[model samples]
Target: MYQYDAIDHQLVAERVAQFRDQTERFLNKELSEQEFLPLRLQNGLYVQRYAPMLRVAIPYGMLSSNQLRTLADISRRYDRGYGHFSTRQNLQFNWPKLEDVPDILAELAEVEMHAIQTSGNCIRNTTTDQYSGVIADEIVDPRPYCELIRQWSTFHPEYAFLPRKFKIAVNANENADRAATQVHDIGLHIKKNAAGEIGFKVIVGGGLGRTPMVGVTISDFIPRADLLTYLEAIVRVYNQHGRRDNKYKARIKILVKALGIDEFRLRVEEEWKHIKNNESTVPAAEFDRLQSFFTEPEYQTLTDNPSNLTEKLADSTGFSRWFERNTFPHKKAGYRIVTLTLKKAGQAPGDATAEQMEKAADLADKYSFNELRVSHEQNLVLADVQQDQLVDLWNDCKEAGFATPTLGLLTDMICCPGGDFCALANAKSIPIAEQIQAEFDNLDYLYDIGELDLNISGCMNACGHHHVGNIGILGVDKKGEEFYQVSIGGASGHDASIGKILGPSFAQEEISRVIRKLVDVYVSQRTAEEHFIDTYRRIGITQFKEAVYAKAN
Candidate 1:
């Protein structure tokens, strides 16, 4: 984790003070609701259905155990004792009082955290692979670059008020893209060319909202040294030309769609030529400085396949199932990356109680070098857990309700806090998610289905990233009645694709049954050893649609 210097501390403290004043003015009636809207939004405060929601940034989803403890403390003291980990990898406190937000920001500042850029139409959090430094297939650790972008975009005067929110994701692994880079406003695929020079394959215009788009490749490669300048050019072009007349049409994706990829690329290239060698061009020394913060953690050398681990797996079916679903191979032989699932039956996806947060912090401190990561999939990662301590960790996780063996399964959904919390939501998402979880509660059945992603969003804002789920559920309001729309074949990663709508929307009660029928179709049609997505692509959406709708009819 990058430690904040005096300057960083001062910046956050000063911002906190400013927001405190702004919040006081609003409460005192010196500022009206409309007047305070942007001010509060800039500080990541949203006036939701029942109370204010405060979104605290967990930059690139990295957190020290100490920081995690602070977050837990804040959640307990200020809000309702739980926080929702969002798809952006930020934490949202749904019940925070408007007056208490400044105090919350001040507390966050002490831990080198803040609510800045978590919301509003500015450049939001820059996310990357959750398994960044620890993954074996990675060509480079993308965190340093993510940090570089974080620093560059933080209150950048040029991009502070874009037409709409901007997101950027970086993926360095050739084999897997846990970061979902293709669905970001700016996606960077890091690679080394045949000449062994590092750079990025840049993609632009991708986003999932009212209009879903997979980013188009603007540049096959941009030298690593010139990354910042190149990014600046892209944002600059969008900031200048992106529509402002209609809020619905203001995003960079809309601009890209209108101008076309070639024209967009030409504009960015022309702008880049002027700024290519400017101060924004990151020097080798700067890269080295950032890289130092994310160097490999200390680990004892051990065999890749530990004998005890194999023995334990063979001994306990419970342990074996959890291990298979929750753990991933680390770059280091002795260490494993463990995902702590926040999705449990009957609970909202990604809602971690204050106690659960504290426990996770304690576990991270005890076993994983006191570091943790938040995944875009709404899970937590202990990225450096030793294989030798797997049993103890699993037991601890099970006690804390974080050891769900449903990663990539139907029940482990990515869901937004829909009509329950978000005023923009047309319908409730948590209920639908819970219903689906109940419908597919059997572990054996889920494992048989294999690697299914079900995502739900209350509206077209797509906060749940429903557009990229294997089964995407979007809440729709038709003639004042809530309905759920289903889509299939969506996927995120190296081969990203937006799902196609199955047919007409279904009533809330019909959603779970529709999902069950979709699963039944997959199970019936799939070939041997095929994943849900692979089978869906092979058979197309027609059969699944027919199965779901025909049953309803």
Candidate 2:
């Protein structure tokens, strides 16, 4: 985790003070609702269905125990006793009093966290693989570059307010697209060329909303030093030409689509000519400066697989299942990346209570060198847990309701708080997530079904990332009633693809049955080695579609 330097502290403190004055003026009637709209949005405040929602940035999803505790404290003191973690690796406080926001901002400042650039037509959080440096066989650790992007994008005068909000994600892993780089305004696939020098394969115009499109690759490689200036060119083009007339069509993805990839590339390249190789180009000293902050945590010398680990697996099936689902490979021989999935039996997919957050902090301090990472999938990560203590950690996680053994499984779905919270949502997503979780509570059944991504979105904004889920459930409004639409064969990762909708939308109550029918079809027809997604891709949507819409004989 990157600790804030003096300059970082000064910049954030100044922003907080500025926002405090702005908030006070708005409350004093000097700033009307319309006047305060962009002002508050710049600070990550949103007027939700019932109340205001404040989004706090977790830059590149990295956190320290102290930061997590501060967040838990903020959640408890300022709003309700819980916070909703969004798919973008940010936290949302749904019930914060508008007056208390400045105070919340001050508190967050103390922990080196803030809500800046989290909302409103500006460069938002720059996210990356949650398992950044921890992954085994990694190509490169992306945290430094992500931090570089953070510095380059935050309150950038040139891109302070674009035609629409923008997002950037970085992924160094070749095997998975955990960062969903293909669906970001700009996706950086960090890799080394034949000479083993680092660079980025830049993908632009990838996004989902009213219009969904996978971003097109703009450059085969942007040299490591040229990333920043090249990025400037990309955003500069979008800012100058992207749709400003309609918010719905303002994202860079739409701009890329309208201009076509070829012309978009040409535009970016033409713009890059003047900007590239300028002062903005990252220098060797700058890389060294940022990389110093992400030094390796002190790790113990131990076997990759301990005898106790094997014994514990044999002793308890529950622990074994959790270990299989929640733990990921680590670069360290003795360490593992353990995720505390928030998808318990009844809770919303990513909702973490204050107590849960505090306990997670405690666990992080105890086992993970006091460090944590928030996954894009809306779960918490103890990225350096030792293999020897796997059973003890599992027990602690089970007690804390984090060991649901559903990571990358059917119930481990990515979901957004829909009509229940967001004013923009067409229907409630939390209840739909609840329905599916309840339907697949059986551990044997869930594990047997194999890995599946079941994502739910309240609307087309795709905050839940429904377009990439194996079974994407989208909430729709038909006539006067709330209906749900189902899409199949969607996937996220190296092989990213959008899902295809089956047919007419169904009533809310029928969603669980529809999901069940889809699952049944997959289970019946899938080969022993095939996962739900692989089956869907192989057998196609016809079988699942028939089962979902099949009439009873």
Clash number for each model: 0, 1
Model 1: lDDT of residue 419: 98
lDDT of 2 by residue, 1-553 (tens): 7888999999989999999999999889999999899989999999999999999999999999999999999999988899998889999999999999999999999989999999998999999989999888679899999999999998788888899999999999888889999988999999899999999999998888778788889998888999999999999999999998999989999888889999999999999999888889998999999999998888888778899998988988898899999999888888889999999978998999999999999999999999898999999999999999988999999899999998988999999999999998989999998988888889998989988999999999989999988999898988867899899888778788899999999999999999999989998999989998889888888988888877898
lDDT of 2 at 41: 94
Give the Cα error of residue 83 in candidate 2, in Å.
0.4
Off by over 4 Å in 1: 551-553
How well does each candidate superpose onto the true structure, as a TM-score?
Answer: 0.99, 0.99
Cα lDDT tens digits, model 1, 14-107, are 9999999998998999999999998889899998999999999998999999998999999899988999999888999999888899999998
Write down the lDDT of every candidate, Cα atoms only.
0.92, 0.91
What is residue 207's positional error in candidate 2, in angstroms? Answer: 0.7
Query: Which ten-residue region of model 2 has the weakest summed lDDT?
Result: 488-497
Q: Which residue pairs clash in candidate 2?
A: 206-215
The C-alpha RMSD in Å for every predicted model, in order, reads 1.1, 1.0
